[model samples]
Target: DEYLERESFETSYFSTVAAAQEALDKHTAASAARDNQSVTGSSAFSEHWDILIIHMVTSKLDSHTMRDWETERNHIKSIPTLEEFNSFLKNRADLLETMEEAQSQKHTRRHSDISHNRPKTFVLIPTTRINCEALNIPSHIKLADPTFSVPAEVHMLLGADLFWAVLSNNRINLGKNKPTLVETTLGWIVSGSIQVPYSKHNKMQSYNTVHCHFLNNIELEEKLDKFFEFESVSTTQQSRTKGESECEQIFTQTTTRHPDGNFIVTIPLKESPECLGDSSQQALIQFKSLERKFNRNSEFKQKYTDFLEEYQTLGHMSENTNPQDDKTSYIMPHHGILREDKLTTKLRTVFNASSITSSGKSFNDIQYIGPTVQDDLLSILIRFRQHKYVVSSDIEKMYRQIYVKEEQRSLQQIYWRSDPSEPIKLYKLNRVAYGTASAPYLATRCLMQLGQECTDKNVGETILHDFYVDDYISGNDDEQTLIQTCQNSPTEFMGEKC
Candidate 1:
């Protein structure tokens, strides 16, 4: 009810500029009428102020002030009233004034002899994992990051100026198997590695890299050129491995076109899928964990549920109606990935085909990871730069356009439910799943096959050579030819419009 009320207020009053202006006028008139009443003070006006406009006030505040506002607001259990916000600001103003007066009375000092040899930018040290528990440092000391045993990529680096400022003169050594503790304003940072007894299985390897460049060395350039030349596709006809050859042969033998013009391809299995044991239990556990996340975030839950519904609406997935034996069918766990940088798709549902089943073999482990069938990125980019007018576009839902064979669909089953209290439903992916190892190869191979059947020779050649996976990147010197190439070659492949 609260959610609906908030949505109604926002939609009615703030959906357009005219509506917002009318709301402002109404509020202004209400304030004026309230002032004329028998109420005694300014508290009457604040108490009557609309709480929805509080965000507008906070948005204009400085970072520190906004953080303080949030801290105070979080302590309130229910929706904070307008009067409470006004009272918070008043108290914040008084506190700032007191701090300013106290700071004004303090003496200022300057340092003259700080070292100039300090680095302008800090670089990461690719250090081995440091064991914090083995150090066994004093109880009074606090580590900067408590879970240092788990490796983490560094997000922020302190420069030389801040580095020296934070450093303290205190240090402690806790013998051979333990690391030393260095004191800093942030916390005590554990330094160095621990030693263990000699064993073949307990060996640690450390690697160091040093970079050197000779700018005007002719010999170096010639050697580098020769090395790249030897590795080039034009110079070397790379031999195919046994697995890759088998995978290609299977794809050729099993691929078929539906009457509707959709290309259906079998899952390239190196081993039988029967080896995979029942994975429904594992998938159920993962589904319950996903439900816990949904319980905390209603907005995220709505978006995720909407995505699944759309997938089903597009015929990418369908509920399994038949009772298939557990030995032949495989269940896949799924998770959501959130990419804030994306403009359209902020959340993506990805199925985990590599999850280990009860038989210790995953669907991916039994299937052959087909060899790369598309042009490399560097080659595509090089060819892309040669044209006078460049154009690039990628296929929408490229993998989903191609259908997996009906026999192979059992290997891609998933368990899902909108709510935790609801009975779990079984569904099978109808199209090629994105996370499967053979998906990229199968999708690209189909495009190559389409290119082979094109009636226009020039358009046919462009489709063959210009594509990198599903992306068509190419151009011609003439604008008309470039536009014509894009129009004729890229539309209606495998029953899908580009």
Candidate 2:
């Protein structure tokens, strides 16, 4: 009985051990099957799993959580001590200082180089007209209108004056040397026309005629010759001074330069006709022809339409509420005050009341003065209500509306120099100019003061208005109410209305 009981116990123990081993093997097989499934899913999925496993393994090895732990480990590894750290910090500070010094030196050198470069200058010449007539006469001149006659001599003098004015003006420095004369040839293609001033004898004699001919150099001639083929020269006669048969001649200059360039005389006609008829009619014809050409050019029309669409889109974008999608509008302020004294005093009073300072200086200490409380009043009024219909009015030159006071004129001094070598000269602002940091603030304050005054009067409710410098947008439910507000406002300088 004892032997049989011992055998039974041993058999039970072996069976239990075998069962445990089988369970362990099954778990291992399941894990391997799941991993194989994951690997076979997709290339991307397999790569991601590999990365995740790598990160998990890395995290377990040496987790650096705190500065003290890092320091302790460094110490164990015989890393730099406190004394070495302090030396390194000092060296780093020195390196930073050196870098800053180097940067400053580089900036100074660049600035010096820029300053040494010669300043550029440009010259502009007013265009003039030259008449081709009063020489010899030829037959078969194509006349547009019988009533019109070309002026022969007056235009040449005008052209000469223009040319001389451009040459003599020393304000424009054309590099180290002036432009040398290349070649001066008469441009026979009539550029533009002007109405001749009436003589004392008859007011009816005034008529439109070709005023000038463009004169170009050899460079321009070569450029013209590449494209244009010479056409022909023809002329006609016109009666000039009284009984003596004066022959007014004209050179019929034509070119096949479809890609237009500066005018060149193809067939030089010695004698031409003064009676080239009405230059206005010829100009109209040319304009019509141009219009037709422009209409025919599909690319140009498409581009123009595209440009207009873009412009409209931009305009709409600017008017929209979304700041990110909108275009920025620039404000340009005019200079000079229409009523300097009154405006200055009004602005000063507003500034004093608000206790506003600019650039860490009191209003009195500030050099430039602008609208103080008026802008705020305006902004509040316009923004008070949103309307379906909005119309904006602009004061032609608002800054001029403010009059500078005689007493305050001396305090409103601004100094500036175009060049470093030049002395800073004080400039008295006669008008309101933008770009002063304090100007907007002052203007807003002034608007606020104005609003208060209006509120006290109980004339009308302040409307919603937005101002970006000079540009103001006023929105109102009633157009008539807006008009009335503008009309009732006392300040009408520079034609600013409600």
Candidate 3:
């Protein structure tokens, strides 16, 4: 019985699609005429889609339903405002949800073996109606529930193939993965629906849903490389004159090398360490926040101490020498309580290289944001969303895991004190500090190298392709395969295991 209802919904959806296609064919001449009048896309939609967009936007002019083509294109000739059209889409999405729920109830009555009272989960694929209708991809729209509500003008110029590619990929991905989501999300007991965002969606409890997105046939890396040429050295200087910012020049001149060849920047020497502006006070605030949290959870306090001990053992930080005339020392400002839930200052009082200094030069101003070697995030997300089973974890203290040569440690100085009366003690970070301009590039480059060195070929490939910084998000058809892949990774003596 449930199968029959699903089949009927799919049939209805395809029938509507056919109706749209026919309407487009009939109005091809009218659509071609619209070319001179500036349509939605920079390039006009191929003659057919232009007509279909108009029909979707103005479907109600002559009749409530489009049984056949409207005699005159006059009905939908006037374009609706983006807001007005969006409202229509919301109404459409709600209507579909209502229909789906009604059908589910009907199916429940006939299927005696299955529980009808299970929670419902929905994966939203909301876009404008035109995005669904006019965009071409020979995908058969299954009418279980679709929630498109974007502006009509936006969809008018969109191509059919692009639209079809996006929608089909998401549908196919969700169809493959739905069974994998069980237990905690109540997937074992609940039926999932694909939808557009609806108003009543927030009211439901015990609802667990994840979005699926389009994965293009072409690799993202290839597409990005083709679009944005990143092979050359690009400078940030924009025709500098008399008083134009010379921070870049200062940074280059001040940039030095340790005996071990690690690049180092000495604070308050060639490059002056900057104050954190309003954020400077955060150090005090974060200290108090931690103090307060310690009073509440002693266990958390223990974790914090253990974390610090682990950090020191990793050689990420250590005590600094006495203040000397030749040595440049800067009081690193700590703020925002280095917290999650409460204060978890990953670094208590670390040099804030990002802060704007008195000379109006920030540490970030001097550094080169090295060439981007990472994959596009959208590409990763889309690919990740497509699988039946997915595993996402983070590498503990990613930046700290890598070592900074001893000679370069002075560049990342900090000030810390146990109490207000206690004299602040100076320290030097022995590893790459967070909030530095090059941290992301440096860390990701190392990660890619690690991926290359990994023994498990499949895991190595996934590490290179799916990781976004410390976060590892990847998908597979089987859970055990994913676990095995992780176990084979080259994570020896990991300080903070993800």
Candidate 4:
């Protein structure tokens, strides 16, 4: 009895395993059948698919179908599942098929009525022809295209499906290796090849080939040629102007270094400072306008006052005592500029040297802008990517760090007042003032001059080439090399007093 019970248990286990295997096979077969049915039915529901898959599939749909899909999508108010999309598509297909069937039946009935009512006759029309006199061909032959002899782009070619329909049973073969002329519904066509002929002078005769070019095509080619010229690799040096050369010479001759390692660069003037007229009236007008704005917005007024105070506190500007009313002394009008994106110092005062003075000439009009002295941003970025270790930092108050000549300080004077009730006073900037035409040249030239004095050649070269305006961006393949280079510079070469 115990043996029978054990055998019975063993039989039950084998049956359970067999049944499970069979169930698994059936489940897999059902899944495959459902997928196949969904594909075949066109409108049948499918399993849910990823939203990205749906987007890709929908992009391939025709305009009318996409419109319907959009309407369904709007009704759903969210991204539709693959099953829902399939159901919607199925309904659209059914409606379209029904309409097509109705249209086909209507057309068939109309055609039947016309066939019964109209006369049974056929009309043969002659093909279009052109004068082949320019080609000097036989008068009996007709040319299909008037400009066939002229070199032009072929718009279309007759495919195999239309070959027999256009071709006729007529053809004329001139001779061996000569082209054959075939008659067709499109008129006569020339096919095959011909041999080149020699002139009486024992040289290959030149074929009179005329090329037809449209105006737009000519314009397109001209534009393409210009694009190619701009894109072509060139290694020519940029030519410097006489004014630029003079500006460079002035910077080299006059630029000096202070005891604190700060550079003193003279303003590169294109015209004599005496050319400038009194700008006191313009400065006063601008001050009054700024006062009106300050009175309206308390927050803006506070920021503006703070900026000027900081500028003065940093010794970047000083009160101009015993100010002269002469051509050499021009007062610049300044306004506050707000930069919301800046984390600190969101507001700053911008001195407008371009403001027109009494003589109808601005200070900027008489100043040499000087040549761009720094490497372009593209070059800086490309070189930045070359190193395993990279570092980026910008000088603090770059322009303010450089000192301007004492005589030129009068030229950089500005009108300022803390409040509307207070009298506006003249203050002269002690550094390379921003917004002046020569400011960029002065600041950049000072940096280059400082770089020339560096003890390390590599550090000097990096400062000369890697710096774009105030920012320093450079790297080295070796980490230790980059560390050493950074350590050697920053304090003396860039970041500090220099």
Against the true structure, whose lDDT is highest?
A: 1
lDDT of each: 0.68, 0.31, 0.46, 0.66
TM-scores for candidates 1 onward, in order: 0.53, 0.20, 0.40, 0.54
Q: Find the 10 residues in a row with the least total lDDT in model 1.
A: 98-107
Q: Tens-digit lDDT track for model 3 on 1-498?
A: 545665456445644654554454334424433532455554546444445554554553333222222322223344433333333333233222222122242333353231111111232323323233322323453332233223211111113334223332132223421311112211111124333334565442222333222223436535544534443211111122322224334334555444543344422223333322222344344456666676777666665556555756766678766545324333345432344544445434344566554555555555545544455565567667667788787777777755654554655565554444676566677777777776676667667655655666765677677788888788777889866756654353121221
Clashing pairs in 1: none
* Cα-based lDDT at residue 320, candidate 3: 69
Model 4 Cα displacement at 144 (Å)? Answer: 26
Worst 10 residues of 3 by lDDT: 181-190
- The best candidate by TM-score is 4
Please write out the lDDT profile of model 1 over residues 25-110, one tens digit for every residue.
Answer: 34433443443343434465555444534655666565545665676766666676555665555444422222111122222343
Better structure of 1 and 2 per TM-score: 1
lDDT of 1 at 482: 75
Residue 338 of model 4: what lDDT? 80
User: Which is better, 2 or 3, measured by TM-score?
Assistant: 3
lDDT of 2: 0.31
